[model samples]
Target: MTKNNAKAYWKENLRYLFILLSIWFIVSFGAGILLKDTLNHISIGGFKLGFWFAQQGAIYVFVILIFVYVRLMNKLDKKYGFDN
Candidate 1:
Protein backbone atom coordinates (compact mmCIF):
# COMPACT_ATOMS: atom_id res chain seq x y z
CA MET A 1 0.00 0.00 0.00
CA THR A 2 1.03 3.59 -0.60
CA LYS A 3 2.17 5.83 2.27
CA ASN A 4 -1.09 7.76 2.29
CA ASN A 5 -3.14 4.54 2.30
CA ALA A 6 -1.06 3.17 5.12
CA LYS A 7 -1.51 6.33 7.18
CA ALA A 8 -5.26 6.36 6.58
CA TYR A 9 -5.57 2.70 7.48
CA TRP A 10 -3.63 3.17 10.68
CA LYS A 11 -5.70 6.21 11.55
CA GLU A 12 -8.93 4.30 11.08
CA ASN A 13 -7.61 1.38 13.11
CA LEU A 14 -6.74 3.73 15.95
CA ARG A 15 -10.17 5.29 15.80
CA TYR A 16 -11.78 1.86 16.02
CA LEU A 17 -9.57 0.94 18.94
CA PHE A 18 -10.42 4.12 20.80
CA ILE A 19 -14.14 3.71 20.33
CA LEU A 20 -14.21 0.04 21.29
CA LEU A 21 -12.00 0.53 24.33
CA SER A 22 -14.14 3.42 25.47
CA ILE A 23 -17.21 1.19 25.32
CA TRP A 24 -15.53 -1.50 27.38
CA PHE A 25 -14.40 1.03 29.93
CA ILE A 26 -17.88 2.44 30.24
CA VAL A 27 -19.40 -0.96 30.77
CA SER A 28 -16.76 -2.26 33.14
CA PHE A 29 -16.01 0.89 35.12
CA GLY A 30 -18.98 3.14 34.62
CA ALA A 31 -21.79 0.67 35.07
CA GLY A 32 -19.86 -1.66 37.33
CA ILE A 33 -18.51 0.95 39.71
CA LEU A 34 -19.64 4.52 39.27
CA LEU A 35 -23.29 3.66 38.83
CA LYS A 36 -23.35 0.49 40.84
CA ASP A 37 -25.92 1.62 43.37
CA THR A 38 -28.43 2.70 40.74
CA LEU A 39 -27.83 -0.42 38.72
CA ASN A 40 -28.10 -2.62 41.78
CA HIS A 41 -31.76 -1.69 42.01
CA ILE A 42 -32.30 -3.66 38.84
CA SER A 43 -31.89 -7.40 38.67
CA ILE A 44 -31.10 -9.88 35.95
CA GLY A 45 -31.81 -13.57 36.56
CA GLY A 46 -31.99 -12.75 40.28
CA PHE A 47 -28.55 -11.14 40.32
CA LYS A 48 -28.06 -7.44 40.91
CA LEU A 49 -27.31 -5.73 37.63
CA GLY A 50 -24.28 -3.89 38.97
CA PHE A 51 -22.84 -6.99 40.57
CA TRP A 52 -23.47 -8.94 37.41
CA PHE A 53 -21.70 -6.35 35.32
CA ALA A 54 -18.78 -6.22 37.70
CA GLN A 55 -18.49 -9.98 37.63
CA GLN A 56 -19.83 -11.27 34.32
CA GLY A 57 -21.43 -8.61 32.14
CA ALA A 58 -18.20 -6.75 31.58
CA ILE A 59 -16.48 -9.97 30.55
CA TYR A 60 -19.27 -10.84 28.16
CA VAL A 61 -19.18 -7.37 26.66
CA PHE A 62 -15.44 -7.58 26.20
CA VAL A 63 -15.79 -10.87 24.35
CA ILE A 64 -18.53 -9.48 22.15
CA LEU A 65 -16.42 -6.44 21.41
CA ILE A 66 -13.62 -8.72 20.28
CA PHE A 67 -15.85 -10.22 17.61
CA VAL A 68 -17.13 -6.79 16.70
CA TYR A 69 -13.60 -5.50 16.29
CA VAL A 70 -12.68 -8.46 14.10
CA ARG A 71 -15.68 -7.92 11.83
CA LEU A 72 -14.94 -4.22 11.65
CA MET A 73 -11.30 -4.83 10.79
CA ASN A 74 -12.29 -7.27 8.06
CA LYS A 75 -14.50 -4.67 6.45
CA LEU A 76 -11.84 -2.05 6.89
CA ASP A 77 -9.25 -4.31 5.26
CA LYS A 78 -11.55 -4.87 2.29
CA LYS A 79 -12.19 -1.17 1.98
CA TYR A 80 -8.45 -0.52 1.75
CA GLY A 81 -7.81 -3.41 -0.64
CA PHE A 82 -5.76 -5.14 2.04
CA ASP A 83 -8.03 -8.13 2.52
CA ASN A 84 -5.47 -10.67 1.33
Candidate 2:
Protein backbone atom coordinates (compact mmCIF):
# COMPACT_ATOMS: atom_id res chain seq x y z
CA MET A 1 0.00 0.00 0.00
CA THR A 2 3.00 2.28 0.25
CA LYS A 3 3.76 4.54 -2.73
CA ASN A 4 6.90 2.59 -3.58
CA ASN A 5 5.06 -0.70 -3.51
CA ALA A 6 2.29 0.73 -5.65
CA LYS A 7 4.79 2.00 -8.18
CA ALA A 8 6.60 -1.31 -8.27
CA TYR A 9 3.35 -3.19 -8.72
CA TRP A 10 2.26 -0.98 -11.57
CA LYS A 11 5.67 -1.27 -13.20
CA GLU A 12 5.50 -5.01 -13.07
CA ASN A 13 1.99 -4.97 -14.46
CA LEU A 14 3.05 -2.81 -17.36
CA ARG A 15 6.00 -5.06 -18.07
CA TYR A 16 3.72 -8.06 -18.29
CA LEU A 17 1.33 -6.15 -20.50
CA PHE A 18 4.14 -5.19 -22.82
CA ILE A 19 5.49 -8.69 -23.07
CA LEU A 20 2.08 -10.18 -23.82
CA LEU A 21 1.27 -7.55 -26.42
CA SER A 22 4.60 -8.03 -28.10
CA ILE A 23 3.90 -11.72 -28.48
CA TRP A 24 0.53 -10.92 -30.01
CA PHE A 25 1.96 -8.41 -32.44
CA ILE A 26 4.69 -10.77 -33.53
CA VAL A 27 2.27 -13.62 -34.12
CA SER A 28 -0.32 -11.49 -35.89
CA PHE A 29 1.95 -9.30 -37.93
CA GLY A 30 5.09 -11.32 -38.39
CA ALA A 31 3.53 -14.64 -39.27
CA GLY A 32 0.67 -13.06 -41.17
CA ILE A 33 2.70 -10.64 -43.24
CA LEU A 34 6.42 -10.15 -42.81
CA LEU A 35 7.23 -13.84 -42.75
CA LYS A 36 4.39 -14.94 -44.96
CA ASP A 37 6.55 -16.18 -47.76
CA THR A 38 8.81 -18.19 -45.56
CA LEU A 39 5.89 -19.72 -43.73
CA ASN A 40 4.04 -20.40 -46.93
CA HIS A 41 6.43 -23.25 -47.57
CA ILE A 42 4.74 -25.04 -44.70
CA SER A 43 1.11 -26.11 -44.57
CA ILE A 44 -1.36 -27.10 -41.91
CA GLY A 45 -4.58 -28.95 -42.76
CA GLY A 46 -3.89 -28.15 -46.39
CA PHE A 47 -3.80 -24.45 -45.68
CA LYS A 48 -0.65 -22.43 -45.95
CA LEU A 49 0.76 -21.57 -42.56
CA GLY A 50 0.98 -17.91 -43.43
CA PHE A 51 -2.56 -17.79 -44.71
CA TRP A 52 -3.82 -19.56 -41.64
CA PHE A 53 -2.05 -17.06 -39.44
CA ALA A 54 -3.57 -14.18 -41.34
CA GLN A 55 -7.07 -15.54 -40.97
CA GLN A 56 -7.13 -17.70 -37.85
CA GLY A 57 -3.77 -18.24 -36.19
CA ALA A 58 -3.62 -14.71 -34.94
CA ILE A 59 -7.00 -15.05 -33.31
CA TYR A 60 -6.05 -18.31 -31.62
CA VAL A 61 -2.84 -16.76 -30.39
CA PHE A 62 -4.73 -13.76 -29.10
CA VAL A 63 -7.12 -15.91 -27.09
CA ILE A 64 -4.29 -17.95 -25.67
CA LEU A 65 -2.47 -14.78 -24.75
CA ILE A 66 -5.50 -13.55 -22.86
CA PHE A 67 -5.55 -16.65 -20.70
CA VAL A 68 -1.81 -16.39 -20.17
CA TYR A 69 -2.15 -12.78 -19.16
CA VAL A 70 -4.84 -13.59 -16.65
CA ARG A 71 -2.78 -16.38 -15.12
CA LEU A 72 0.32 -14.19 -14.95
CA MET A 73 -1.56 -11.28 -13.42
CA ASN A 74 -3.03 -13.57 -10.80
CA LYS A 75 0.48 -14.69 -9.87
CA LEU A 76 1.63 -11.11 -9.82
CA ASP A 77 -1.22 -10.12 -7.58
CA LYS A 78 -0.33 -12.88 -5.18
CA LYS A 79 3.32 -11.89 -5.26
CA TYR A 80 2.43 -8.32 -4.32
CA GLY A 81 0.08 -9.46 -1.55
CA PHE A 82 -2.86 -7.97 -3.38
CA ASP A 83 -4.77 -11.14 -4.04
CA ASN A 84 -7.98 -11.80 -2.18
Candidate 3:
Protein backbone atom coordinates (compact mmCIF):
# COMPACT_ATOMS: atom_id res chain seq x y z
CA MET A 1 0.00 0.00 0.00
CA THR A 2 1.08 3.54 -0.57
CA LYS A 3 2.17 5.59 2.48
CA ASN A 4 -1.07 7.55 2.50
CA ASN A 5 -3.17 4.41 2.28
CA ALA A 6 -1.19 2.79 5.09
CA LYS A 7 -1.65 5.85 7.28
CA ALA A 8 -5.38 5.91 6.67
CA TYR A 9 -5.65 2.20 7.39
CA TRP A 10 -3.93 2.58 10.73
CA LYS A 11 -6.04 5.61 11.59
CA GLU A 12 -9.23 3.72 11.00
CA ASN A 13 -7.92 0.70 12.90
CA LEU A 14 -7.09 2.87 15.90
CA ARG A 15 -10.52 4.45 15.81
CA TYR A 16 -12.17 1.04 15.92
CA LEU A 17 -9.96 -0.04 18.78
CA PHE A 18 -10.78 3.10 20.73
CA ILE A 19 -14.53 2.69 20.30
CA LEU A 20 -14.53 -0.99 21.20
CA LEU A 21 -12.34 -0.48 24.25
CA SER A 22 -14.58 2.34 25.43
CA ILE A 23 -17.60 0.09 25.29
CA TRP A 24 -15.83 -2.59 27.27
CA PHE A 25 -14.79 -0.09 29.86
CA ILE A 26 -18.31 1.23 30.27
CA VAL A 27 -19.80 -2.25 30.59
CA SER A 28 -17.13 -3.52 32.94
CA PHE A 29 -16.38 -0.51 35.10
CA GLY A 30 -19.42 1.69 34.75
CA ALA A 31 -22.09 -0.95 35.08
CA GLY A 32 -20.13 -3.20 37.36
CA ILE A 33 -18.78 -0.68 39.83
CA LEU A 34 -19.82 2.88 39.31
CA LEU A 35 -23.50 2.16 38.84
CA LYS A 36 -23.69 -0.92 40.96
CA ASP A 37 -26.36 0.30 43.33
CA THR A 38 -28.74 1.38 40.59
CA LEU A 39 -28.16 -1.81 38.65
CA ASN A 40 -28.54 -3.96 41.73
CA HIS A 41 -32.22 -3.06 41.84
CA ILE A 42 -32.62 -5.21 38.75
CA SER A 43 -32.10 -8.94 38.54
CA ILE A 44 -31.16 -11.44 35.90
CA GLY A 45 -31.70 -15.16 36.47
CA GLY A 46 -32.17 -14.31 40.17
CA PHE A 47 -28.80 -12.63 40.43
CA LYS A 48 -28.43 -8.92 41.02
CA LEU A 49 -27.52 -7.22 37.78
CA GLY A 50 -24.61 -5.33 39.24
CA PHE A 51 -23.20 -8.40 40.90
CA TRP A 52 -23.68 -10.33 37.71
CA PHE A 53 -21.88 -7.70 35.75
CA ALA A 54 -19.03 -7.69 38.21
CA GLN A 55 -18.75 -11.46 38.06
CA GLN A 56 -20.05 -12.76 34.73
CA GLY A 57 -21.66 -10.09 32.64
CA ALA A 58 -18.45 -8.25 31.97
CA ILE A 59 -16.78 -11.45 30.83
CA TYR A 60 -19.61 -12.22 28.45
CA VAL A 61 -19.48 -8.71 27.03
CA PHE A 62 -15.72 -8.91 26.57
CA VAL A 63 -16.03 -12.16 24.65
CA ILE A 64 -18.77 -10.75 22.48
CA LEU A 65 -16.63 -7.70 21.83
CA ILE A 66 -13.82 -9.96 20.73
CA PHE A 67 -16.00 -11.46 18.03
CA VAL A 68 -17.20 -7.99 17.08
CA TYR A 69 -13.64 -6.77 16.79
CA VAL A 70 -12.67 -9.72 14.62
CA ARG A 71 -15.56 -9.09 12.26
CA LEU A 72 -14.80 -5.40 12.15
CA MET A 73 -11.13 -6.00 11.48
CA ASN A 74 -11.95 -8.39 8.68
CA LYS A 75 -14.06 -5.75 7.01
CA LEU A 76 -11.40 -3.16 7.59
CA ASP A 77 -8.75 -5.38 6.11
CA LYS A 78 -10.83 -5.91 3.01
CA LYS A 79 -11.49 -2.21 2.72
CA TYR A 80 -7.77 -1.46 2.82
CA GLY A 81 -6.87 -4.32 0.48
CA PHE A 82 -4.99 -6.02 3.31
CA ASP A 83 -7.08 -9.18 3.38
CA ASN A 84 -4.55 -11.12 1.32
Residues 38-65 of candidate 2 have per-residue lDDT tens digits of: 9999998889999999999999999999
Total clashing residue pairs per candidate?
Answer: 0, 0, 0
| Candidates in descending TM-score order | 3, 1, 2
Clashes of 1: 0
| Reference-based lDDT, each prediction | 0.96, 0.93, 0.95
Q: lDDT for model 2, on a 0 to 1 scale? A: 0.93
Model 3: lDDT of residue 12: 95
- Candidate 2 positional error at 36, Å: 1.3
What are the models' TM-scores? 0.90, 0.89, 0.92
Model 1, TM vs. native? 0.90
Candidate 2 — worst ten consecutive residues by lDDT sum? 1-10
Put down candidate 3 lDDT per residue, 1-84, tens digits, no spaces.
899999999999999999999999999999999999999999888999999999999999999999999999999999989999
Q: Lowest-lDDT window of 10 residues in candidate 1?
A: 43-52
Tens digits of lDDT, candidate 1, 1-84: 899998999999999999999999999999999999999999988899999999989999999999999999999999999999
Q: On TM-score, who's better, 1 or 2?
A: 1
Q: Candidate 1 has which clashing residue pairs, if any? A: none
Error of 2 at 44 (Å): 2.3
